[model samples]
Target: MGRKEDQDKVQSVLELLKKQAPLTLKQEKFCNKACVERFLKAKGDSVKKAAKQLRNCLSWRDSIGTDNLIADEFSAELAEGIAYVAGHDDELRPVMIFRIKQDYQKNNSQKLFTRLLVFTLEVAIQTMAKNVDQFVLLLDASFFRSASAFMNMLLSTLKIISDYYPGRVHKAFIIDPPSMFSYLWKGMKPFIEYSQLVLVVSSLDFEESFEFNDYTSYPRVTSLRFDPSSIPSTKLGPCSSSRFSFTVSHSCDSVKPWYLSLTDTSASKVGPTNSSQISLGPVISPLNARSQSFASPIDRGLRRNDNFIRKGFFPSTPMPQKTQSLDPSMIHHPRTPKPSFLQSPALFFRKDYQVSRVEKSRDSFQSFLKFYRRPYDEMIYRSKMKPPLGGLISIVSPQLKRRHMSISQRF
Candidate 1:
């Protein structure tokens, strides 16, 4: 009934609401905090109810229109899991970051790409409602799975956003190929023909890209600078060399800087005994150092402990060492051919030696290899050669289908 009692009660309610609407590994915390305060102030008498409403407002629990294609099995499960994850946490709801590595097409259709992306973006956007801001995306060149059936679903969706919302995306991009965005034409070039431009960010010597116009014209890119402060000096540990982004940084610099060069001694950027050779030479220009880093999407949140809590959201996984990549081709691939059985996951799993199918198949390995090499002279193979039906066909060839009859030898 008293004024002081009312003030304390309201403050407590506001605090609880702030704690509940966690900022998680995202960028929306400041807006969330301000929004919560406003909500509480408005509903003075029943501020607890107001706080609850505010929390729900900030969450993905609210109604969002979904493209009917995604309305089926996966979307329902996704919605529930996101809400479930949000339910367990402190203040922030979990954020989902989706990036497109390739301009996706189904069989060979843009319509297919659009529909898939719509469905994907629908759920991904919904997933971002309560928890995430676009601040921290854990980008690995090998963009692996995050959750159930994620790779297929995620790639499909990211392609859509890359085509549509280039300016909005703030996640750190790694060197995943076939990914088309404002500049890169890994796959989505058809959609952006003559309309957009892609900049070559790396410092390496690249064959000239197929031409497209850069859209520095509108909302216009008045200036662009690579922010090096956000990039981590070391990706793995003390003695490993980074392949992608550092080379891009090297590309921007003149006078073979040791850090940019493959042969720098100050760096553990390479590997094993050779890592010591990878080092940044003398800093040449201040601009190069600035260009050397990717300016990370700024975090606007308060600190908690060893980890900082932006708003109320905690980092779901570890914060990534933001990397600036050269081009997709630069991400490391071993030049040597790996044994088929050792190379792929599908093969590794199905390769039970006891299986009669596998034993029969092995007999024909030489037959398949026969065509791969032309009379066994040249070792050069097209690095980009994909197998028939769209993947490494050498690994999964029709010869696999042919039954090699066993000829039991009689002495």
Candidate 2:
């Protein structure tokens, strides 16, 4: 369809939606021209279908109380780095990364997972660049094993995105997927409308293709701000000794490549130095020195305490202590052996005990029957039991039962 025709269809769909049900203030803010256009494109430019979908989307958003959702409510999930909006892709579309390895099936609650998914998408939408309505998804499946356990959650999330937030996924890349991931993709392919947009690539290919620089770092919550002016002036650099140990520069420009820069002075040195030779002394700041000192002993390559040797290590085994030699006279004679079961059967079994093979077999069969029939027996007994006289009287006439049974007991 031509651009003008598409615009007309979008407008008609918007008018139809309005005629069907008046949008509230919140819905009005959400149902913009872009949103209507997305729905139209999702519904094959059919005016009635698009309007129906928009109505359903609005109703779903209202039921979930989407307007009231806040990032603080999902702080735990966000902190785990399971899902978050980070840097943008080569297309300038905001990228949302999902670390499948960090998702624990034990802690998975469908409701909370849905909320987290919606919250992450909202943040990604807020961070999107102008004229970019869709976002890129990076599924980091490295070392992820419990795909079957998470299939339900994953399918539900896909359903929500496809049904409500149509045309919002520009592309999805599965990074470093395990061997078992092919099965997962097979299951997910049916739910995904734009299968061509989903690609499976190695970590290296993802980095080179997407140009995502900070893939390893955790997303800063401050980056979710829609206004660029609210962002900090300086971006955080890579950590050296500890998480807090990072270099800061005044300029907001991207860092220069190490190969391009002849000297390392720009990264380490505070000011121009006289010596032509590269120096590492100035790189260690007072804060970095403290951080290094407080760092883990294993990370710092320091020897662990002798008392804290690792389990199964050579040093952890107990050593034999010195003792005097034992003499024959010091050793006591061994206790007399007990009578065998065959020699003195009376000691083990009761005096009146009798073995009857037929009785034993019959008892076993009877026990098995009882075990299987217990539930049916209980149901029959319950059916035969009479209803309380108070309840019967209340059903026939309340006044007659009121004198016999108190209200609390009758209930």
Q: Cα lDDT of all candidates, in order?
A: 0.36, 0.60
Candidate 2 on 245-350: residue-level lDDT in tens? Answer: 3454445564742221122333543433444432322233333333456765543432223454434324575789968788889999999988765765665674
Question: Highest lDDT among the candidates is held by which one?
Answer: 2
Each prediction's TM-score versus the true structure = 0.20, 0.48
Q: Cα lDDT for residue 128, model 2? A: 72
Span of ten consecutive residues with least summed lDDT in model 2:
370-379
Q: What is the alpha-carbon RMSD of candidate 1 to the true structure?
A: 33.6
Error of 1 at 19 (Å): 41
Return the number of clashes found in candidate 2: 0
Candidate 2 structure lDDT: 0.60
Q: Which stretches of candidate 2 lie above 4 Å from their native place? A: 1-3, 101-105, 187-191, 204-411
